[model samples]
Target: MIFTIARKEFRSLFAAPSTWWMLALMQFLFAWFFFVRIDDYLQVQAQLTQLANAPGSTIAVASPLYSALALMLMLLIPLFTMRLIAEERRNRTWVLLLTAPVSVTHIVLGKFLGLMLLLVLIVAGSAIMLVTLLLGTHADLGLMLANILGVLLLSASYAALGLYFSALSKQPVIAAIGALGMSFGLWLLELSASDNRSFLRAISPNAHFQNLNMGLVNSADLIYFMLFTATLLWLTIRQLNDERRSS
Candidate 1:
């Protein structure tokens, strides 16, 4: 049943022309950045070779791409997630979902999974470009996989937070703005808190993501992502249940 809802949401997103336009825009931006990075790497290749411990192609090229991709997810996921519940509520379709046989948990999970599929598509688009690195240079497979994992987890956290905001507001624009504000706020928190041991930096998703982006996958970072995602998902479920009771 969760998958059924997820599939429906996935198809619905693809049905909209705006979705295609957004995807195209993202890919275009990624391609531009990717080529620019490659060009820069080539320009500095000679200098890097002279260094005792020079970074590889993966570090020089793919790391920055993934970092940019993470920033892109922060901006784009909210746009899609805003419509998940807020639009349905605005259209008077949320009542249908509320009265449906499926539990609130299922609905929330389904919506989140649907968004995950879109996130995966976006990440895969970037991955396709990263794969081309193998042709010209030796790519760091381990680092690449770590970055991929970091991206997926980071996007999932974004989606979960956005989902909660979508449930909180009937206006899709408000939901989008709320999600964006919170995401940016957390990023600011990471920046302002300079101490690595500070609680604020410890709670910021960007900090944890940076750890994985550097290919240092610690258990602490993994746990942070899990707790962050699970807490928001739980809150979303509770919000929907409260709405169901109120209605």
Candidate 2:
């Protein structure tokens, strides 16, 4: 039942022309950033060749690329997530979904899963540029894989939160702004805080992703992302339930 709903939602995303245009814009941004970063990395590599060998040289070489990719993904996710529920509500289609035989939980999970599937496509597309970097270069494949996984998990978390916000608003434009504002604020909070307040860092997906960006697979970070995504998804279901009952 959930898969049926998911399929419907996933197909709806592609039925619209705007989704394709947004995806194309995102791909162009990623490709442009990749080219600039690769050029910068090559220049740095040439300089490093003349310098003494540093400890953990391989990790050092890969960190910049991972960092750049992570930044690019952070900016792209909100655009995809903004339309998850808000647009449906705006178009009067959410009521139809609410009146369906499926439970609110099923609806929320279905939409979430649909967005996640689309995210996989976006991430896989961006990965082609990263793979291109491996040609004639000494890149750590394991580290790169870990970074990609981290980005996916991080993007999922953001998508979940954005979807929740989308469900909360009937206005898609408001949902888009709200999602971006919330994400940007969370990023700012994590960046402004000190390590002594690391407990607060657990609340920010970007913070957990920072560990992943460093090629460190901490169990705590993985758990944080899972819990964050699950919690927000639950909230979305609850919101749908409340809205349905009120209607």
Candidate 3:
């Protein structure tokens, strides 16, 4: 049943013309950044070769692309997730689910998974460009894999957070703004916090994502992403359960 809902939601997103437009725009932006990175890398290749411990092609090119993708995800995931529950409620479709036998947990998980599958498509598109680099130069497969894992986990966290905000309001615009504001604010906090041990920065997902971006795989960072994503998902489930009871 959860998978069914997920499949339906995934198909509905692609069915919308807006989704295609947004995807087109994102692809253009990603390709522009990717080509620019490659050009810059080529321009500096001579100088980098002279250094005792120069950064590899993966670090010089792929890493920055992933960094940009990370920022793009922060912006795009909220937009994608905004309609998850908010649109359903706005169109009076959510009421059907409320009256159905499906558990709140299933609904939230299904919605999140559906959106995540969409994100996977986006990540795969980005990976194609990254892999193309292998045709010209040797690529760091381990670092690339780590970055991929980091991106997937980061995007999932964004989706889960956005899902909670979507569950909070019936208006999609309000949901998008609220989710983006919270996600962006946390990202800003990661930059503004001076103390390394400050609780605010420590709690931000961007801080943990930076560690993964460095190709350092820590269990703690993995745990942080899991806990952050799970906490929001749990809150979303509670919100739905409350709504079901109230209705």
Ranking by lDDT: 1, 3, 2
Q: How many residue pairs clash in each candidate?
A: 0, 0, 0
Per-residue lDDT for 118-190 in model 3, tens only? 9999999999889998999989998899899999999999999999999999999999999999999989989
What clash count does candidate 2 reach? 0
Model 2, C-alpha of 103: deviation from truth (Å) = 0.8
lDDT of 2 by residue, 1-247 (tens): 7787778778988887988987888778777766676566666776777878732333664556556666666666676677778888878887898888889998888888887888888878876667765676666777777788898998888888888889888888888788888888788878877883576676777788878877789888899889989999999889889988999
TM-score of each: 0.99, 0.91, 0.98
The residue pairs found clashing in candidate 3 are none
Best by lDDT: 1
Q: Which of candidates 2 and 3 is the stronger one according to TM-score?
A: 3
Model 1: lDDT equals 0.95
lDDT of 1 by residue, 67-123 (tens): 999998899999999989999999999999999889999999999999899899899
Model 2 poorest ten-residue lDDT run:
54-63
TM-score of 3: 0.98
- Model 2 clash pairs are none
Please identify model 2 stretches exceeding 4 Å from their true place: 52-62
Residue 108, model 2: lDDT of 83
The segments of candidate 1 whose C-alpha lies over 4 angstroms from its true place after superposition are none
